[model samples]
Target: MPTTFRQHRKQDDPVLTVDFTRFPLAPGDRVLDLGCGAGRHAFECYRRGAQVVALDQNGEEIREVAKWFAAMKEAGEAPAGATATAMEGDALNLPFPDESFDVVIISEVMEHIPDDKGVLAEMVRVLKPGGRIAITVPRYGPEKVCWALSDAYHEVEGGHIRIYKADELLGKIRQAGLRPYGTHHAHALHSPYWWLKCAFGVDNDKALPVRAYHKLLVWDIMKKPALTRVAEQLLNPVVGKSFVAYATKPHLPKAQA
Candidate 1:
């Protein structure tokens, strides 16, 4: 009886958008949310009736997510058939056997890994045939603005090592043996909000415009409706903050076999 958080709040944004359509989990599915920062998507999977494993390199966040999972279990917020657990693990080398999960999520994580190919291969290795994987990275245009604004923004500890173009990422996924199925942009409003922050200072949330825009973005995610819907969809392809691509492991044997 784990707790659940309704994620219907952002039907337009990229990460959650992919979760809604691309990563639709059925009851009894085994799902993996790699680099699950704070477990947002993991919680959503559990709520949607999947056994979810939320993994991250950060032990603290994993601990917090585990605590929340425990609390949710006690509070009876999770779906009747779903459960969740959190663990610490690295993306480049996952701690699971081949074909371990029916679905895998890697949201806003690939950019942080230098060997993104290795990470993708690990994800592919653990996915069951015909299993799905959803990946989200900062969209090229918006990320370029941040790069132009400050060298330090992407140069500091745990900072992004590379910004991916959608096509390039899709190609990479294909190279890792997954078949691309769909692509979309999300968090359109948040792009300019982050642009404002990067222009001010990446860490300067205290600045007036940055602070104000941050609040607005938070409000938009919390109370999503018609206006945000039109705005996000209209802005996504052009200026969305994140690019999400969904793919599946083709259910075919290797050509050599």
Candidate 2:
């Protein structure tokens, strides 16, 4: 049976990487977090005063995310009028009508699905004209190193099926009828941590180097140390662990009959 692995995800996500300002979400905007693994981005959207829908295929994850949503509501972590909903759904065929959402987020999810283009199509289908999307995938070089280091790093069930080059991913977004606008890399400090884990053993949490690096990551995430933040920002362009692309659905010019 698959465990929740809640302990494995203690660190808050790298919010700066998503750069929500570029997406231009406003209060009451409809936001969909496709494949939201535990509602990290969804929660952020809610906090920004958007109506957030956190969708995932994993029932267990959805349940956990729903609990978090309720907790956030009870604790007033979200904005005054914000709302959130967590649901189980298929990414390839979203249960939404065309042009339904103002913003869509599919973070660190494309590499896991074999039919990536199909999933992109579904995201595009659900996005309103002029809507924006942010897609994140495991960067090619760093992910290649992890794959080279250990088969277990990605050869497991539901693991990343492929690595995506930045250009290749951008092209797929364009093919899906979205206009590519901006791109960035993120989590540069995390590349070496994964490399260490892959070098020893993916599951060897007790390994000294792995444990130390994990601690460092936890600190970097929780503390926001100035030096490490500066270093990560500098290294992100060169060796970030993930590549993020932002795109918008183009509004077609009116047809002349």
Q: Largest lDDT belongs to which candidate?
A: 2
Candidate 2 per-residue lDDT, tens place, 1-257, comes to 01222222335555445777666679999999999997788877887899999999999999998887776676666787788999999999899999999999999999999999999999989999999999989899999999999999999999999988888888888889999999888889989999999999999999999999998888887677899989998999999998989999999899999
Q: How many clashes (backbone N, Cα, C below 3 Å) per candidate?
A: 6, 0
Q: How many backbone clashes does candidate 2 have?
A: 0
- Residues 1-257, candidate 1, lDDT per residue (tens digit)? 22132243142233364547655778989999999997778877876889999999999999988887776666666778787889999888889999999999998888998899999999999999999999999999999999999887799989899989888999999999999988888878888887887889888879999989878777766676679879888988899889989999989767894
> Best TM-score goes to which candidate?
2
RMSD of each: 3.0, 3.8
What's the distance in Å from true for residue 73, model 1? Answer: 2.2
lDDT of model 2 at position 235: 98
Question: Against the unseen true structure, what C-alpha lDDT does each candidate score?
Answer: 0.84, 0.87
